[model samples]
Target chain A: MKEQILKNLSNYLELLQERFGHEKIWEELLISVAEYGDSDIYHNSIKESLEKILEVMKIDEVLCALDIITDKIEGFPKEDLLKYIIYIKNEYCLEKENNLREVKEALTELATPIIRIWHDIVLTPLIGTLDSERAQAMAEKLLLFIDANKAKYVILDVTGVPYIDTVVGGFLMEMIKAVRFLGADVVITGIKPDIAHTLVKLGVDFNNIIVKRDLETALKYVINLIEKR
Target chain B: MQERVVPIIKIYDCLVVPIQIELDDTTVEKIQKQILSEIENNDVKGVIIDVSMVDIIDSYISYTLSETATMARMMGCYTVLCGIQPQVALTLAQMGVNIKGIYYAMNLENALEILAGIEE
Candidate 1:
């Protein structure tokens, strides 16, 4: 009976390995969160990525599952970990995969019946991690959006962002540059104190990217710029 | 039946092709050739390409895209690159690829509006 139990454990280990191929744990967690309500393509990738993370971390199966599932949820219940097992398993088995591709699709998903709001004024709201990949995508989208809309002013609100590194900071500068090139003024908002300190420490110059304390102030600033123009 | 031949949506009377993958030399060439042919065969005023599907575009691809837009304009067809991912835009900016004079839109719908306004 002990040997049989060991044999079953080995089989389970193999299954876990197969699920996560090569992705990191954090990526798996993030991807899982994103893919929670998506299709099979996304669903499988998240599972596989998570599985790989679990194996690489060499975490206990039960504990690993608990952690990943909790991370996947926006607001995980702060109850006993055991009590959450069923919920975790349900989410793990049923949730879809959320990958970079899905995010891209989501960004452009606003294509139908296009918002023809006056380009004479524009607002490009940015949210989440301002990593290089996401920054570039946002820059391109905003520039094109601004040019297409012929907006005189573009407002970039980063209130939802947790942090900004050099690469991302540089991307913000790029957006300002592109917006100005298209004859539009840019107003930046949501300058968190920590983010400000990080930027200063990086020795990066935000001398040009117009910044404001919050979205409300930035909105007012943008309105002033547009009116003047 | 075979997959339906997607209708060529008209934007500024130009054929706006929505790309569904990363932009590489080969894909850009394929798109360029398609645009050239469409320009010659149809009264395409411009091309608005949606590249949000593209996660990464190397400098070479960026160059080609810029060149293609210029070529389209020279051929009497304006080009608009729409729905570029924000991150991609940042990279392009760092690399100093001036995608100027090339109309850009946040999405296909926005692209269409830009093209339509220009058409009017």
Candidate 2:
């Protein structure tokens, strides 16, 4: 492949130069094909050209480039060229997936923290929409803290949460059930009007678990219970 | 399978059961029987079962424990489940396994305190 590319290098340059207008990228692509056609440098060169081409040129132009190189250069395997481009595309997709996974992991960590707020009471601020996985995680961590600290009350503040549908409401109930079984009462606060409207209209009962308007009222109610005890 | 006996240390009127072995179906049943018999024979006031060392407690084992607690309750003795590992508790919570008729305390000390309060 290297020998074939070197043999018809000048002709290939002329064809690409006509289409690409004497750009330095064509020279880099040619040298990489000649010296390290099967190596990582050629891989990077092909990747760079595709990114650059996709930036300014249309997809048809790219397809035209593919046709030009494969036809103009004698004995050049189109499969090998396709292999490089496909591999580059696969790597790009995997890189994007990896970044997405990292972002999800970070969001989960930040979202599900059960922090101690007051004596015999721990508070967890529920941010983002609630799902089964996140609610299960938050419940697990909150239960442990309640046991370890012997917390008598759990205050779930949903101030940052944007929405809570019926399914999310069920998850919330499950978590609340688990907390109560541990001998701790759960106090949920900070329901938006739209969420409260939906929750009541859906017949999702907050009658069992104590619901307060805000964290301050919830804390005051807990304190009142503590003193009454 | 040979049944291994978990030691039941009598601390005053309350019995302290520290479960140090892996609990299979047969072993769990056997332990429950032993605890019930020990409670009856000794006229124990309260029972504190520490499960910090036990890694897993399935639905059946937890049900058996709850049954034991209920039975003990009828016999005028309280049962306090102590030191449930965080992971085990999470599994139980996620499974929605409600352990009725038993009080849960974080550790042995808390368990003893619960016993003292119950006896009073």
Candidate 3:
């Protein structure tokens, strides 16, 4: 079975090289061999020879070549070869999905850190898009940190947040109130004019909350409050 | 059962009423009447409603509180609400009930400080 497969593959390789160029044909052949090789010493040797023939190839080209080979190979169990291709495609897709999920989790942790900048003062600098899940996670994290640290003041720097919708606006209000309940005042900084407009249009009242133009002003105000105390 | 009465404590020239019980319609009305009467009797300059122990505040109660604050203001008393739980504030904001012109302090001490500042 292995000998028949290899003989058909090599014959098709030469036919592909004649129709396409030698350079393109060899690269696609190498990738196909690498993707569909069986776990046998003989198949491993076949793959090694194909690898030496090509430097690099696009995955789409290799998949295309596989489709052509499965069709052209006469009397060989085309079903078996197609199964191997399907298995390889599924594995690749799963690996890509896993990598994407890992990146998202890393970004979430990176964006929502609660840092204690001074005694009785903590700063939470939010960056990236504010979605409902991210907003809820931030609220839980900031509230827990304030209660645990006994922080008197929290400076919420939203310079990196691009915009706010009604859902996020409501969650932000909830977070501010939670901080106040824990006996710590929240100072919001770095609200862009556009965001301010959105909040107003959403009918969000910021009359009770303290807002600052920038982090510098917020820090100065916190320091003065501490000094006065 | 005997009718529940809200206590009004007089601190200096301010009438401090810490709402330790949950407020229903009758309780809120009774408290409002008591607060107005106390303001008139003591001639106090400020009224502090400490809501630290009260967990839930509905729209009706919120409206009542605002009305009571307005009434107190008319009778020459500054009404300050202190110790409103964070959850209550969030609920009120979500409910779209604006407690406008009513002052809030973090605690009773801060409420007293605000009243003192106003006195000065």
Per-residue lDDT of candidate 3, residues A37-73 (tens digit): 4433234433443443322445465446556766775
Tell me which residue pairs clash in candidate 3: none
- Which scores better on TM-score, 1 or 3? 3
lDDT of 2 by residue, A1-229 (tens): 7877877777777878887654566666666666655654446665676566555666577667878787766554456666766766688799999999889777877997788877888888988987777776677777778877888788989899898877777667767766765557789899898778777876755666799999999999998988774
On the 0 to 100 scale, the lDDT of residue B117 in model 1 is 65
Q: What's the lDDT for residue A61 in model 3?
A: 56
User: CA shift at A14, candidate 1, in angstroms?
Assistant: 62
TM-score of 2: 0.80
Chain A TM-score of each model, in the order shown? Answer: 0.49, 0.76, 0.73
Fnat of all models, as shown? 0.26, 0.32, 0.11
Could you give the C-alpha RMSD of every candidate to the true structure, in order shown?
17.8, 4.2, 7.7
Per-residue lDDT tens digits for candidate 3, residues B1-120, read: 223387789999999998988789999998988898888789688999989898899989989999999999999989888877656665665566667557777678878877887853
Docking class for model 2 is acceptable
Q: Which candidate is the best by TM-score?
A: 2
Give all candidates' CA lDDT scores: 0.61, 0.78, 0.75
Candidate 3's chain A scores what TM-score? 0.73
